[model samples]
Target chain A: MTAEDKILPKPLVSVRGLRKFYPAGRRFPWLRSKPPILALDGFDMDIFPGKIHALIGPNGAGKTTLLKILWNLIQPDEGLIESNHLADDDTVLVSGEERGFYYRLNGWANLVFFGRLSGNSRQETLSRATQLAERLRLSGILNRRYQTYSSGERQKLAILRALLQAPRLMMIDDLAKGLDPQATRELTDILLELARDGMSILLATHRLDLAAQMCDTITLIHRGKNIATGSPQKLSQQVFPHRHYRIVLSGDEVTARKILAGSITSDIEIKDGHLSAELVVSDEEELAKLSLTLAQNGISIIELSSLEEELETVYNHLLQDSDSNDG
Target chain B: MAAFFIRDLQIWVSYRLSLFLDIVGLVGTALAFFLLGLAFEGYIPPMLEQYGGYFPFVIIGIAFFGFQSNGLYGLSGSLREEQLQGTLEPMLSSRITPLSLSLATNTFSFLRTLVRAVLFLVLGALVFSVDLSSMNIPSAIVVLALSLPPFLALGMLSGAFTLAFKRGDPVRLVYGGLSVLLSGLYFPYQLLPQPLQWLAHAFPLTHALSGLRAALLNGASFSEVSTQIIWLLGMGVVLLPLGIVALKLGHRKARRDGSYAQY
Candidate 1:
């Protein structure tokens, strides 16, 4: 590492106007050709220092394509990617679902082989592999042939190989793939720990619940473009601007319904002629005022709670909006 | 470099039956040549008289020509194997340059071929009783040293085509087939037609086999084989750079088209 003072506050990876189009085979000459599918189009993103960012999208949303571009494995037809000067050589790495491993070699042998290829010394690689294996709980399987390892174990091995040198920028795709819930949680915790230790992580995942739990920032992509990029809460606000409140109270149903219906949008439930209500308020002030008015009307509140919008809901809502617009 | 060799050595040693067959095949092939040479001893061509007999002459041809073919096929063969095993892309993504990777991938096969070639000569002398051997060892080594680059260069060109097209390699299919027939492995060069011999001169192996047979059978000195050495070196000079350029072009095209991992 160079002098810490020299590190730039600018984005570590600044991507702008990226575009990629895969070629489709042509056979018919008499008819006009259909437009090719755009895998990435005018996409832009910025990864800052020591933060966990996620790329989340539906199928065919180009999340994998974007990560492949960022890793320099695939070149975009048009784009500018200003790499972070501090990240060079083995300082950056990527882990994907690609089974680029020797089937006959034992797990430890593969790690050492790949570690050396990544510019690590043999002794250094063995030591690091042992440490990482223990951490990943893969120590038990290190002696087994790679072909015999389970899918979850295989993914962990990929992560272990990626972490052999403690890269500053690590990109992983298909996060939580082939992993059990416990393994996914363990992986997420370690990723969070790595980020806290000043490693910037970029993960492409379909699991919004896990992404919301782990990522500091989430970017929703659709049709090969970024449709939304922000914190989970900020994106939820973008989807659900009004706050949702649920309350159960013994009150005059007519009066409560009259005020809520005129002033806000709400749902009221009645069971055995008893009233419970849910309302959408635009702001904290509105929620507070509604509480006061209910108290003023002798509506004793038995239960009241705010409903937080989940990342999955926000992701789905944004995708729906994007699809509607495209349609 | 050591890693590449060790990785392949470990894997190659793991296949016990294949390893057994390798030894059997080497001795068997040399034995066949010795028997053929014995049967045709009295009818030896005048051009081969200086080489003592057909056994001594043919031994040098098969041994060194096999070495040359190893360099020609080892690189692209390893590449195809790795690509099928899904291990090629990761190595391609590593810190090593394409040049180093290409050379390193072939290192194990390179030395293995040299060892097999030396053993082939030993078997001919020990079991076949070819001759006491007035071989100029240093001259033979010089010819081998001069001859390998062009074959390896040809291997790189073949591997470059495999890397880009990710399918049938025209370079290897056409070049490898022609070299075996033209390199004078199983026959004397003088037996070929005039126009064919002219075409054979363009291949480095023709000169390489001639130089090796002369050094081993006739005890030709380094200076005596200068013409063959010069031709081999010239081929190396022209082909090595061309091979590297073709490899770079293939790598770039594969990256641009996103076909590196397709195979």
Candidate 2:
């Protein structure tokens, strides 16, 4: 593309060519004779303003490393990290485990302590904590010692501590780990509200369902590198190539195959002695056309379900591609 | 010593500046020690004759020993506590500057140690019939106040070592082993071997304790202890900046090694 034609939106945080390594072997790092193992090797991603960008990978895929670097808990060995919003008070990193707080202190005391650390007044932190805790359903527990909190409640308290800072960018690792469905929903809604209020969140999670539900863009990572980055639908298309639907029919599969023969990319499979067929549709237009053609025919659809939301399919496909490329 | 040094972890967790319990504990300790000194009052050695007896001299010795511990371990010990408690990364990432954090920790340690020393002296006078009515208060204050920077500088260096390696700081370990032996905490440095007495002069606490004994016990003026005061000021001038630089290097090294939260 010409320079004039190449229009790109600005990101709140931009990263490029990040690299980190840890010395291998059980000996001390400096004395270890083995070569270092790369944790983040030329990793790259961008976080747009007000968008939830997800980093999904297997264990040891360097999601935590990236978040730590962004939070300045650690620095990358090599990278260009550009962000004016990365000051100590302007950004925050919330770790998944709820172990960072002073357990002996009660929730309000802990909040006030961390708030002062983040450069906020005690009164301001208390006011903000009152509002945020109510939304998190943790208002009653503010007076209780942190060590007495339940596991999920402890995580919520940590989240509340982070939110009290009112950071411009928040990098949360494992957003849904150890959280129940109701708590996850509540957190998701609060996160959405915050994003709508113009806070950029870079979430690292292994939960594909959560990413698909809330992330505006999903960045699939593997082996310290970005394999793919796009909207969930776009990634699904990139990995899946087409949509698969399992159709249970009352009539014979022969009639359905005849109707969908030229429309579908893959062969219709009959399964379970029931007249059910799995067909791949190229796009929404073709899917609609197939449905209309089936209805026009004398066959009745017992059950029709789209497998587009099967994000596991996307992960497996992309990971296989990445592994193959590595090999 | 490692465990006792981190008693400041309570202050860290509470973030309370009052230290009321610490003072109460210090008073109890002072009273208990006064009883011990009363028992030993009859067996005063010839070297302790000028200082009035064993109680005043040894009381100055141990109380200041605790103060020196505050200066040496307060910075690193608190950091080690945060590291173990998993708050180091968050605290480091907060808006608090390293200068502010160091000053706050060292100030708390110094103030707490100062209060402990004063309580020991006050209790020695009121309850133990130890006369300090003729003591050079300004000289004692100057000696105590000037002694803090060198100790804090040493603490910062130890803190740097703790940050870089995460544990087993040689400054804390070696000094802990040697301070009570050579810095005249339990006995006079003149009692040590000639070579060890020469080595003891290198300890800032040795100068501080010696000056304190002369000022508090002998009522020596500041000019009389000018040699010790100059040594402390000079050491503070050199080591304080060196400590800051070392701490900065240690933090950078830890960041580069990606071990900020590995403890």
**Candidate 2's residue-wise lDDT over B1-263, tens digit each?**
21122334453546555456766777777677667767877865689888877778878887777778888888888788888888888888874555566666666567667767787888888877777877898998899888888888888899899888888899999977787789887778888899999999889999999999899888999899999999999989999899889888988888877787765
Could you give candidate 2's per-residue lDDT for residues A253-278 as a string of tens digits? Answer: 78777886765545555667556666
For model 2, how big is the CA root-mean-square deviation? 4.5
lDDT of each structure? 0.82, 0.81
> How well is each residue in B122-194 modelled by candidate 1, as lDDT tens digits?
8988988766368899998999998888988888898888888777887678777887787677777668899
Q: What is the lDDT of residue B108 in candidate 2?
A: 56
Model 2, residue pairs in steric clash? none
Error of 1 at B144 (Å): 1.1
Model 2 DockQ reads 0.48
- Report per-candidate DockQ: 0.67, 0.48
Mind listing the fnat for each candidate?
A: 0.62, 0.60
